[model samples]
Target: MSSAEVVLDLVRSRPPTLGEGRLLCIDGPAGSGKTTLASQVASAGGDAVVVHMDDLYEGWGGLAEVGAQLGTLLLPLAVGSSGSYRRWDWRLDGWAETVTIAPSSLLVLEGVGSGVSLFAALTTVLAWVEVPPELRLERGVARDGPGVAEHWAQWTHDEQAVFVRERTRERADVVLDGRVP
Candidate 1:
């Protein structure tokens, strides 16, 4: 069965959080279909909004800072009211556009460490998408190309740190097998 199917079924079986103020976190490594799955979920989730944490980063160097702010400030605003932000463009490393999260929305934070400890209290469900390292590397290399070999090495370190601190996997309400784990 498709991973999305499993996730959809799992989510459907649970009480729908539609029209409720809650957060559902989809945490996983890069290229693990977090965005796609979250999109599928929020589409069916009544009054839901998908929030990409990647947009919170400030030129890839402010992940922790952005994450902290999201957990502490923006998420609460998003739960009941509209939230707004001026996002940083990764490629350009500059302010791009002002993004907004609406009230009574089902916000999906699809990025590694998104559902970290900071968000635990507000998160109603936590989903972890497990993708083996070899397969993950293969997919990553394919997308970023051989030119990113060094970058990947550094990313592995960053990922490890994030997971170590966040522990999003162990706290998962469900595990999503993306054909690799």
Candidate 2:
């Protein structure tokens, strides 16, 4: 089977911490394919709710805050309640939108901090996707354009610190080479 199909099966087999919906996290450094992998998995698993950590982040320096917000807002979803969070508007430099997620058969949280320890107990599977730094940086610059180059550098530095401290990959239930097909 294809990689997505295999992952889909694996996610389906895991038990949900909440009512009946499995909580899956696809986490990795920026441009490491966490979002792509999460999308593939979500597409394969019908009726899945996908939450992008990018939206939850307050800004380039908001990883810790995002994790805390998720802990406060999303953790309760384990008991079957709707959850919402204000999304940061990169253009306006402030919170400009509210996003809500409903309970589902599967929920995919995708982004750098998606595998944080705060959600470990509630997560059914924390999948770490890894790509070489050079490739990841290339992808990030290409995606965000040259104007955000400095921001990407700072983000990379902050991500390394957080990853080392959180041991996100070490805590992962599955590791995916995001470069692979």
Candidate 3:
């Protein structure tokens, strides 16, 4: 079967595939189709929780503090109970808003590095959304603007370092071009 067919099959049959209290992460570089695909999956099921990590990233805390939250809090909840999370607040530079995560057979978290293994041990799948670097850069530039040039450059460097260490793509269950879906 084709990759989309696989994804469609996996997502459509999610309650069975994911079971209760399992986390599924959809990760990709910025501008890949993570958000859209997560939405599609969530919408397909009547009871699926979708978490966007973009809300969790705020200011210079970067992944460091996010790691703290995941380790100290989210993982434990995912382990023991069905619960919802309040995504991090970027504008206020502190998290104030709480988003409800409905109880469901599938809990999908999307955005950059959502599939990274550190966040949850019981991951049902780690899907990597891939696109050419040129395309990634182009989409990133369009979304963030040239003002983020230095930031983008720095991220590219960090990502390169990370790819060497973390190997996000190699760990993925599925690799998607992401432009098509």
Best by lDDT: 2
What C-alpha lDDT values do all the predictions have?
0.68, 0.82, 0.64
Name model 2 segments beyond 4 Å from true.
Answer: none
Residue 163 of candidate 3: its Cα lDDT? 47
lDDT of 3 by residue, 59-176 (tens): 4336433443444335545556444455666557686765555446667777776765565455677788878888888888788678666677666665555445557788887888
- Candidate 1 regions off by >4 Å? 5-19
Give model 2's clash tally: 0
Which 10-residue span in candidate 1 carries the lowest summed lDDT? 11-20
List ranges where model 3 is wrong by over 4 Å.
1-5, 11-19, 64-66, 79-86, 98-100
TM-score, every prediction: 0.80, 0.94, 0.77
What value of lDDT does candidate 1 attain over all alpha carbons? 0.68
Candidate 2 lDDT tens digits, 1-181? 6556767787788787756788888888999888888788877889988888888888888976558668645666788887777888888889886777777888888898888886788888888898999999899889989888889878888888888888999998888888885
lDDT of predicted model 3: 0.64
TM-score of 3: 0.77
With candidate 3 superimposed using the best TM-score fit, by how many Å does residue 105's alpha carbon deviate from the native? 1.6
